[model samples]
Target: MASYKYDIASGAEAFTFNSVMRACTKEVAALSWCMQHGLIAAKAVCSRCAPPPFMRRKGMHWRCSRSSCRVERSVRMNSFVERSTAPISKLVMVIFFWASGTHVTEAAQHAEVGGDGNVVEIDATSMTKKQKYNRGKKHADY
Candidate 1:
């Protein structure tokens, strides 16, 4: 697994079972095992208990070796419900906003992608050569 000893031993308040479960896939057996063995808490009562394979690094990316019956998944894949569509940067922004104690409306305002207070539509034909150049950073110098 991704040896989360850093989180466990950080000396601040440690993650609870609920938080760990939030980061895990809905693999009931593994979740139950974590709860029963106290791996959900810092200073696990059973640290030697094997972690699921998906948490382990096989190469540049982590993946499970079990093809017959998959029981594990990466934290990223497990943590978010709609990970494919949303950009990772946006997800980080949400986490950052949550941690910083900012209200959701302010965060949404800061991360605006579409129009202003009123909808400002754009068209491909309206984009001038200069605008396109600026958009592409064509004037950038090394």
Candidate 2:
């Protein structure tokens, strides 16, 4: 069984459950967070003939602004969500559910995944990446 933890000491004030839902299910939220936090971006200068723009949403991915570049980047390229095999939506759903007072096991089921797991998500301002990484969160949903 896998376990997850959320850091909700004092700084995790901004992330309401609804916001998390939007981020997980909507490209705009995903892309917005990725770009705002610098999680995904290609070279400002294109490898091709034209200078590619910054990171922009193209369908389900963050691709080079210049459509011709064809450079698609993972939204989780560098953030906490980089390696989990689970769907982003499931991850976010479980985390929010847990924070909203749902039990860990129930949260995982709400995410529609098997096994028992604990999820802990702290506000970006409250905890450091090292702290989050230390809590056994091998993968993130959003």
TM-score of each: 0.27, 0.44
Across 39-131, the per-residue lDDT of candidate 1 in tens digits comes to 332111112335533334332223445554333333334344235555434554555567768797877765574545657577655343353
Which tens-of-lDDT digit does each residue in 1-142 have in candidate 2?
A: 8898876665444466656656767645655644554544532433444444576655555666664666776656665567876665565666568668988776655554544475556555534234364576443432
Candidate 2 residue spans exceeding 4 A from truth: 1-14, 18-52, 97-102, 112-142
Q: Which candidate wins on TM-score?
A: 2
* Candidate 2: Cα lDDT at 77: 60
* Residue-level lDDT for 26 in candidate 2: 60
Q: How many clashes does the backbone of model 2 have?
A: 5
Displacement of the residue 25 alpha carbon in candidate 1, Å = 27
- lDDT, candidate 1, equals 0.43
Instruction: Flag clash pairs in model 1.
Output: none
What lDDT is obtained when candidate 2 is compared to the true structure?
0.57
lDDT of all predictions: 0.43, 0.57
